[model samples]
Target: MSFLEFSSDAFIAAFFLYCFGFLFYMIAIGGKKWSNRDPEQHVKRWGRVAYIVSTLGLVAHLAFFFTRWIGAGHIPTSNMYEFMTFLGMSIMIAFTVIYSIYRSPLLGMFALPLTIIIVAYASVFPQEVQPLIPALNSIWLKIHVTTAALGEAFFAVGFAAGLMYLLRVVDFKGKTKEARRAQRWVEFTLYVIIVVISFIITVFVFRGMGYEAEFKQMQVNIDSRGQETTTEENVQYTMPPIFKPYNSETISMDSFIGMKQPLLETPYWMDGVNAGRKLNTVVWSIIAGSLLYGLLRLVFRKPLGAVIHPAMEGIDPEDLDEISYRAIAIGFPIFTLGALIFAMIWANIAWSRFWGWDPKEVWALITWLYYSAYLHLRLSRGWQGHRSAWLAVIGFVIVMFTLIGVNLIIAGLHSYAGV
Candidate 1:
C-alpha cells in the first residue's frame, strides 16, 4: 500500500485502540462497586492496562501522522481533516503528560472519550490529499498551526478537568430548586456533547452509504463593477435536502421544503460554494443528534448526570480545579505566540499586511482575550475553584469556535483552510 493508504489504515487501527483503552479506563473507574477484591488494587491493575493500551494507540497514531507527513511532503495541517486529527493527537499527548503528574485514572475517564469524539469528528471531513495553495506554501504553516493545536490541546485538558471539578462540587442531590436546575443544565450539556458526536457519526455513516441530493440554485456574485448578479449552478449535498434557498431554481424532487429569497442576502464577500447545502447539512446534523440523544435518554431512563455521578466518587474537586488552571496557564503563552504572533508574521508575508481582521484572525484574538481574562480573573481577582473552573470550560468553548466555527461559518482569507 502507498504511505498515505498505510497512514489511513494506521489511523483506523489507532481509533479502535483508543476506544478499547477508553472502555478499560471506564471499567477501572466503575469496577470498584462490583468487585470483591481490594478496590484500589482493582483500579490500579485495570488503570495500568488502560494506560499501556492507550500508549500503544498513541504510538500507532504517531505512525499515522508521520506517514501522512511523509506522503504529503508537508506538515498535515492545511485542511480541516488534517488539522482536527492533529488536534486530537495533541490532546492525547497533553492528557498523557498531565496524567503522569497527577496519576489520576479519572482524568483518562473524561479525556479519552473526548479524544475519541475529536478523532471521530475529524473523519466527517474530506480526507483526500490535496496540493498546498500559494498561501499555505510556507514553513510557518507547520510551525504556527502545530503550536496552536498543541496549545489548544492543553486547553482541552483543562476543559475536561474543569468539567470533572464542576460535577464533583455541584450539589446535584440537594433539595433546593437551584441545585436541581444546575444539575439539569449539566445533564443537558452532556447531551449536547453526545449530540455533536452523534452528528459526526451520522454524517460519516450516511456519506459512506452514498446518500446524496442535487439541485440548481441561483448563485449570487458581484460583477467587476461591484454590482450583484445571479447565475444558475448545480448544487450537491451529502444529506437529504429538507430546505432550499429562496433564490433556488430548477428544483429537484428531493427538496421537501422551499421558500422565497429572504430580505437579507448573504454578504457579497462571503463566497462559499453551496452555502444552502452547508446549511442543509447543519440542520440535518442537529435533527440526527437530537434523535440519537432522545433514544439514549429513553434507554437509560434517567438523567445523564445521575448516571455519571457514581464514577466521580474518589475524585477531588479542588485538585481538578487547580490542574485546570495550570493547564491554561501553561497553554496561554504558547497559544499567543503561535496563533497571534506567528499568524501575523505569516499574514504579512502572504497578504502584504500584518492584520486584516479576517474572521479567523478575529476569532483567534477573541480566544486569546477570553483566556487572558480567565487567567486574570483567577490570579488577580482571587477567583479559584468553581469560578475558575467555569472559566476554563468557557475558554475551551471559545477555542472551539475559533478553530471550527470561524472556519466553517465565516468566509474569509482562511476559507481555503476548511474542507
Candidate 2:
C-alpha cells in the first residue's frame, strides 16, 4: 500500500484507540465513589489502563504524521485536512503531558472527546495529498505552522480544564434561584458541545455516503470594463440543499428539496463555486446538527451534563482552575512567537511584505491580543476561579477562529489553505 493509504489506516486505528481510552477514563472517573473495594485503588487501576491506551494511540498518531510527511515529501499542514489532523495530534500530545503532571483522569474525560471531534472534523475534508503551492514552499511552513498549532493545542487543553472547573463549581444543587439558573446554563453549554460533535459526525457520515445537492445562485462578475454582470450558475454542494436562490435558475432537478437562498451574495472576486460550497456545507451541518441534538434530547430526557455531573463530584474546581491558568500562561508566549513573529518573517520572505492586513493575519493578531489581555487580567487584577476560567475558555474560541474561521469565511492570501 502507498504510504498515504497506510497513514489513513493508522489514523483510523488511532481514532478507535483514543475512543477506548476515553471510555476507560470515564469508567475511572465514575468508579471513584461507587467502587465496593477501595475506590481510590479502583480509580487508579482504570486510570493507568486509560493512560496506557491513550499513549499507544498517540504513538499510532505520530506514525500517521511521519508517514504522511514521507509520502508528501513535506510537512502536512498546508490544507484543512492535514492541519486539522495535526491540530488533533497536538491536542493529544498536550493532554498526555498535562495528565502526566496532574494525574487527573477528569482532564482526559473532557479533552479526549474534543480530540476525537477535531480528527473526525478533519475527515470531513478531502484527504488526497496535493502538491504545495509557491507560498507554502518554505521551511517556515513547517516551523511556523507547527509551533502555532502546538500553542493552540495547549490552549485547547486549557479550555477543557477551565470547562471542567466551571462544571464542578457551578452550584447545581443550591437553594438560590440564580445558582440553579447558572447551573442550567452550564449544562446547556455541555449540550452545545455535544451538538457540535454530532454535527461533525453527521456531516462526515452524509458526505461519505455521497449525499449532495446542486445550489443555483446568481453569480455576479466584474467585466473587463469594471461593470457588474450577472450569470446563473449551478454549484454542487455536499449534503441535501435546504435552500435555493429565488432569482437564479436551477440546473439540476435532482435536488431533494429547496428553500430561499441567503440574503448575502458571494463577493464578485471569489469563485462562486468555492463560496457556495462553503455556505452549503455550513447550512447542512447546522441542519443535521439540530436533528442529532433533538434525537439526543429525546433519548436522554435531560441535558447530557446532568447525567455526567455526578462523576465530577470528586474533582476539585480550584485545582482545575489553576491548571487552566497555568496552561494559558505557558502557551501565550509560544503562540506569540510562532503565530506572530515567525509568521511575519515567513510573510516577508514569501510575499515581500511583513504585514498585509490579511484576514488571517488580523485574526491572528486578535487572538494574540485576547490571550495577552487574558494573562494581564488574571495576573494583575487577580482574576481567579470563575473569571479566569471563563477567559481561558473564550481565548481558545478565538484561537479556533484564527485557525479555522479565517480560512473558511474570509477570502484572502490564506485561501490556499481551504479544503
Candidate 3:
C-alpha cells in the first residue's frame, strides 16, 4: 500500500482505539457500582485500562500524523480535514497529561467523547492532501497553525470539563427560577453539541447516498487597479439544498424525496458562492439536529441534561472547576503566541500589513480578549464554580466561531484553510 493509504489505515486504527478507550472509560465510571464488583477496585482497574488504551490511541494518532506528513511532503494541517484531525490528536494529548495529573476516570469518560467527536468530524471534509500556496509555504504558517490548534485543543478540553461541571452541579429537577434558567441554558448547550454532531452525520449520510446538486454563481471583483472581473463559479452541494446561491442559476439538482428545487435563496448579505454552500450546510445541520433532538426528547421524556446528570454523580464539581480553569490558563499563552504574535508576523510578510480588519482576524482577537476577561474575573473577581464553567464553555464557542464560523460565513485571506 502507498504511504497515504497506510496513513489512512493508521487513522482508522486510531479512531477505533479511541472508541475502545471511551468504552473502557464508560465501564470504569458506570460499572463501578455493579452488584458483584468492588467499586474502588473496579474503577482503579478499568480506569488504568482506559488510560492505557487512550494513550495507545494517541500513539496511533501520532503515527497517522507523521506518516501523512512524510508521505505528503508537508505537515497535514493545511486544510480543514487535516487540521481538525490534528486538533483531535492534540486534545487527546492534553487529556492524557491532565488525566495523568488528576487520575480522574470521569475526565476520560467525558474528554474521550469530545476527542472522538472531533476526529469523526474531521472525516466530513475532503481528505486529499494538496500543495500549499507559495504564501502559505512559510515556516511561520506552520508554527502559527499548529500552536493555535494545540492551544484550541486545550480549550476544547476545558470546555469538556466545564460542561461536565455544569451537568454535575445544575439542579435539573429544581423548580426555582434560577434553576429553570440554568436548565434551559444547559439543554441549549447540549442541543448545540447535538447540532454539530448532526452536521457530521448529515454530511456523511448525504455523501453515502451519492447526492449532488450544482449551481453556477457569477462573482464580480474589482482590483486595486480599478479593473473589473466577473467569473462564473460552480458550487456543489453533497446534501440536499435548503438554500441555493443568491443570483445563481441551477445547473443540475438531483431530486430528493420529490423535492426538485431549493427551498430558499442565500441572503444577499451572505454573499459568495462558497458562503452560500456553507450556509446550506449549516441550515441542514440545524434541521437534522432539531429532528434528532426531538427524537431523543421523545425517547427520554426529559431534558438530555437530566438524563446524563445522574452519571455525573460522585464527580466533584470543584475538581472539574479547577481542571477547566487550569486547561484554559495553560492554553491562553499558547494561543497568544500562535493566534496573535506569530500570526501578525506572518500577516506582515504575506499581506504587507501587521494588522487587517479581516473577519477571521477580528474573531481571533475577540477570542483572546474574551479569555483575558475570563482570567481577569477568575483571578481578580474570584469567579468560580457555575460562573467560571459558563465562561469556559462560552469561550470555546467563541474560539470555534473564530476557527470554523468565520471560515464558513466570511471570505478572507484565511479562507484557503477551509480547502
Candidate 4:
C-alpha cells in the first residue's frame, strides 16, 4: 500500500485506542458510585487507571502521527486537518506535562474524550499527499502555525477546566434531592477534574486526526496543438473525496479576476493561484467534522448543557472562578504574541504586507476585545463565579470564532484556508 494508506491505518488504530481509553475512563468514573459514598478513594484509585490509559493513548497517537510525517516528507501541519492533529498533539503534550507536575488525573478524564471526538471528526476528511506552495514553504509557516495552534490548545484546556468547575457547582446548586445535595461538593470536584481532562483532549487528541488536501495544476500539452487554441477546459479535484463542498464544481476562469472568484468562495486562500484548493479541503474537513460530531452527540441523547458534568460544589465557586481567570491571564499574552505579533511578522516577510484587515486579522482583534472585556468585568465589576465563568466561556467562543469560524465564514486575503 501507499504511504497515505499506511499512515491512515495507523491513524485509525490510534482512534480506536483513544476510544478504548475514553470508554475505560467512563467505566472507572461510573464504578465509583459517587452518590453513595466518599468518592476520594475511588477517584484516587481510578485516577491512576485513567492516567495509564491516557499515557498509552498519547503514545499510540504520537506513533501514528510521526509515522505519517516521515511517510509524507514534511510536518503534518501543511493542511487544516494536519494542523488540527498537530494542535491536538501539542495540547496533549502540554497537558501531560501539567498532569505530571500537578498529578491531576481528573484532568485526563475530561481531556481524552474531547480529543477522541476531534480526531474522529478529522478522520472523516481525506488524508492525501499535496505539495506546498512557495509561500508556505518557509520555516515561518512552521513557527507560526505551531505556536498559534499550541497557544489555542492550552487555552482550550483552560476552558475545559473552567467548564468542569462550573458544571460541578451548577449540579449541586440545582439538584433538589436531599441525599444528592449532601456530598455535592466532592462529586463536583471529581467532575471538574474530568472537565480539565476533556478540554485538554479536545485540543490534543481529537484535533489530531484532522484532514487536508494538496493540489497543483500545470499547463499540459493536450491534443498535440501545433496551433494553440484559446478554448478553455477546467478540471476539478479533491483530497478526501468525501469533502463535497461545492455543487457547481469547476469552471474555466475568464481572466485573473475570474480566478479570484473561486478563491473568494472557498475556505483556503493561499499564495498561489491554485493554492487555496488544498487549504479549502482542510477547512471543509474541519467544518464537516465539527458539525458531524455535534450532530452525532445530539443524536445520542446527550444534553447540550450536560456536555460538561459531575459539578464540584465543595471546591468553592469562587475558587473555580479564580482558576479560569488565571488561566486566561496566562493564555492571553501568548495568544497575542502568537496569533497577532508572530503572525504579523510572518505575513510581512511572506506576503509583503505588515497588516491587513483580512477576516482572520479582524477576528483576532475581536478575540482580543472579547478577552479584554472579560478581564474588565472580572476586575472592575467584580464578576465572579457563574458570571466570570460565563465570560470565560464566551471569551473562548470568540477565540473559536476567530480561529475557525472566521476562516470558514468570511472572505479576504486569508481565504487560503479553503474554509
The lDDT of each candidate is 0.84, 0.82, 0.91, 0.60
State the lDDT of candidate 2 residue by residue for 233-293, as single tens digits. Answer: 6777565555444345446533343433343444445454556456655666666667776
Clashes of each: 0, 0, 0, 38
lDDT of 3 at 139: 87
Better of 1 and 4 by TM-score: 1
What is model 1's C-alpha RMSD? 3.2
What's the distance in Å from true for residue 324, model 2? 0.6
By TM-score, the better pick of 1 and 3 is 3
RMSD of each: 3.2, 3.0, 1.9, 10.5
In candidate 3, residue 13 scores what lDDT?
94
Is 1 or 4 the stronger prediction by lDDT?
1
Better of 1 and 2 by TM-score: 1
Worst 10 residues of 3 by lDDT: 31-40
Candidate 1 clash pair list: none
lDDT of 1 by residue, 12-50 (tens): 989999999999999999997898999999899999999
As a TM-score, model 2 comes out at 0.91
What candidate 1 gets wrong by more than 4 Å, as runs, is: 221-228, 250-273
lDDT tens readout by residue for model 4, 283-359: 54455555555564568565334443543323455555555676677667777777888888888988899798878
